[model samples]
Target: MKKLTLFASAFLLSLGSYAQQALWGGTNLVSPQINEDKTVTFRIHAPKASKVEIEGDFLPPTKVDTPFGPQDIPSRAPFKEGKNGVWEYTSSVLPSELYSYSLYVNDLKMPDPNNVYQNRDIATMTNIFLIGGGQADNYMVQEVPHGTVAKVWYSSPGLGMEARRMTVYTPAGYESSKKKYPVLYLLHGAGGDENAWTELGRAAQILDNLIAQGKAEPMIVVMPNGNGAQEAAPGEAPNSMVKPSFMNPKTMDGAIEKAFPDVMKYIEKNYRVYTDKNHRAIAGLSMGGFHSLYISAYYPNKFGYVGLFSAATSKQVNKGVTSDVYENLEDKLAVQFKNAPKLYWIGIGKTDFLYKDNMDFRKILDNNGYKYTYMETDGGHIWKNWRIYLTEFVPLLFK
Candidate 1:
C-alpha cells in the first residue's frame, strides 16, 4: 500500500508540474482584461487563422424569427487583425451585468485558450465575466456568509421514480442553528435541471447576499428537475452522457405538476422547514413558470407566494391526453385566489416571445377580477431577465 501510494503521489506531482508549466506559458497574455472603464478587452492568439471574431451578449442582440415570434439572440463582431500573433477586440462600455463570450477562429467555434473562467450552457461552453457595481453585484460572491448547497436525492413515487435528485440551498447559519426556515421552490426553464439556478441564475450568490444584508428573509431554495422523465441532469444520471438539447417534450406536460407533491414532501420530511401555506413559496421561469402556475393552481391552498418569471402561461397541448392537473384552469385560479395567496407575482420582458401569451393570461385575470402584481422590463426571453426577476422576487418572500 505504501509503495502504491508513493507512486500515485509522484504521478500527481508530475501532472501538477505540467499544468503549472502550461498555465505560466501564457502568464504575460491576458485575454479578458477589464479596463479602468467598464469596457473589456478580449484577446486570442491565432497566428495562422485567416479570421477571428467574437460572439457574446455584450454586443447588440440579433433578432431571429422563431415559431412564437422574433427573438433576440447574441450578436457577433469581428476582432481586429493579428498584432504580433495576438488577435484582439475591445468592447464598447458595458453596463453592470454578467456577460458570456464565445470565440470563433476561421468560422470555427473555439474556447478562449487564455481565459479559464467559463460556463457550459447545454453543449456550448463560453467564457464569462461580471461587470459589477449594480444588480450584477448581487450575482457576485462577496465577503458575506455563504449558504450550503446540497445535491440531495429523494423518492418521487408520484413521478414513478424511486429516487431523484434536487439542489437545496440552506442559509449560511442553517446547520449550526436549530430554528426552522421557510422554503422557496425555485424551478428552472426548459432544457435546465436542478443545477441551472445555481449556475446560470446565481441563486446561491443572490440568496447569500440578500440574507447577509438583511434585504430578504433567510429561506431554503429548492431547485428540482421539472422534467418528469429525467432522474437528474444529463451527465449526473446513469443514462447517456451526451449533451441534452434545449427543449424536451416531456417537460411542462402537466406531469411535473401532478408529481410536485413528492418534491415538497421530501423537502418537508428531511429538512427543517415550516410546513404551511404562508411559509411556502414557489416560482419558476419559462417552462418552470408553466409548472409553477399549474402546480400552484392544482394545489390551490398549498403556497402563499407564487412567482411567474417569463413563464409559459399556456399549457402544452397534448393530444389524446387528459389530466386533472391541466383541466379547469379558471376554476382552479378562482380557488387559488379565494384562498388568497399573499402574492401572485408575474414579471416578463417586453420583447420576450411569451410576452403576448403572458398579456393574454393577464387579460384572463383582469376579466375575472383577480388581483396580481406585474413587472415589465426591457429585453427578450433570456437569463438576464430571469436573474433580475429572481433577485427582485426573493426579497418580497415571507416579508
Candidate 2:
C-alpha cells in the first residue's frame, strides 16, 4: 500500500510538469500583432466559448459583383480555435488606418480582453488597433510638442441649463505665450459628446502632429456637448447615461442654437481668445455639421470659417416649423453669404448616404451666389473620413 501511494504521487507530478511546459513553450498569444507587411494577427483565449468571430474595420474589403460593377463590402471572419482555448484569426493586408473591432463570443459582442486600447462610440465600446504608415501615422502620438485637453464645466443660461461640460484643447505654448489664440468650436455627431473628438477622432494627436509639421496653425479647440439635454458624457453627466436628444430635431429646437451664446460667453470670459469672426471658426461631423451650418448662418458675421463634414443637409429645417426661426433659412443663408466668411468649406465622401443632400444644399449655395470650396474623397460617413476632413480643414483655418 505504501509503494502504490508513492507511485500515484509521482504520476501526478509528471502530469503537472508537462502541463506547465506546454503552456510556457507555446507562443505568447499576443492579440493584434502587426506583421511586417501590414497584415494583423488577432488572438483571444476563450476556452469555454462554443464559437468566436472577429469583426472590425481593418478586415479586407469583400468584392461583390454588382450591376454597376464590383462593390467592396466590409468583411468579418470566424476565428479558428487552437489548443488550450486560444482562438486566432489573421487579416489580409489592410490600408494604413486606425481600426476599431470587437469579438463575438458565443454570438455576444464584446471588446477584446487582450487589447488595452479601446474606444467608445455612443454606448458601444470596441477595441482599437492601428496599422501605421502614410496618413495613419498622423493619428498616432509622436515626439512632438503636445497640447493640453481639459474637461471643463460652465454655466449655460442661454439654454436654461445651469451647468454644462465641454472639452477644450490649448496649444503647446498657449500657457507660456502672452498672445491670444484663435478658437475653433469643434462639434461632434449625433450620439456623441465633447469626448468624441479626442477619443475616436484622435483630435489632440492630429493637432499636435499638424502644428509640429507646420501644416496647421497654433490655436485652441473647444468641443462642446451638442446634446442640449445632456451636460456631459455617460458617467460625467449629472444623471449618468441620460438619453441623448440630439437625434430628435424637435428636442434640439432653440436648445443648442440658443445655448451658443452661453458657450461663447463662458469661453471668452475664461480663455484668452481672439474676439473677431476672422479668428473664430466652427466645424462638425454629421449632425454637428448641420448645427455649424445653421449657427454660422443664424449669426452671420460671427464665424469667418465654416466646415461641414458629411453634414445632415437633408434635415436642416425641422419637419414642423411653427416658429419663423427656420422659416426663412434661404434668406438667412443669403445674408450669411453677403457677409462672406473667409472660408466656407464642405467635405463629403463619395459613398456617403448624405451625398445627395449635400449636393442639393450646394445648389442652394450656388443659387445664392455663395463662394465655397468643396472636397470629395473616398469612403462613407465614418470616423476615418471625419478625421481626414479635420486634418484637411485645420490647415486652411487662421491663414
lDDT of each: 0.90, 0.85
Give the runs in model 2 whose Cα sits over 4 Å from its true position.
1-28, 60-74, 242-251, 321-323
Candidate with maximal TM-score: 1
**Tens digit of lDDT per residue, candidate 1, span 1-399?**
999999999997888887956745664678788897999999988889888999999899999998877989898898887667788899999999999989999999887888888876766788899998898999999999999999999998888899789999999999999999999999998888899999999999999999999999999999999878888888998874867877765675667888899999999999999999999999999988988999999998899999999998876434465778888899999989997899999999999989988999999999998889999999988889999999999999998
**Once model 1 is optimally superposed onto the true structure by TM-score, how far is the C-alpha of residue 87 displaced, in angstroms?**
0.7
**How does each model score on TM-score?**
0.93, 0.87
lDDT of 1: 0.90
Residue 96 shift from truth in candidate 2, angstroms: 1.3
lDDT of 2 by residue, 1-399 (tens): 999999999987887787865545445668889999988999998899999998787766666766434555566799999999999899888888899888999999887876778988886778998888888888999999999999999998876677889999999998888889999999999888889999999999999999999999999999999887776787887657554443643234746865687888889989999999999999999988988988888889889999999997754435554534445778888888887999999999887777888999999989878899999998777899999999999999999
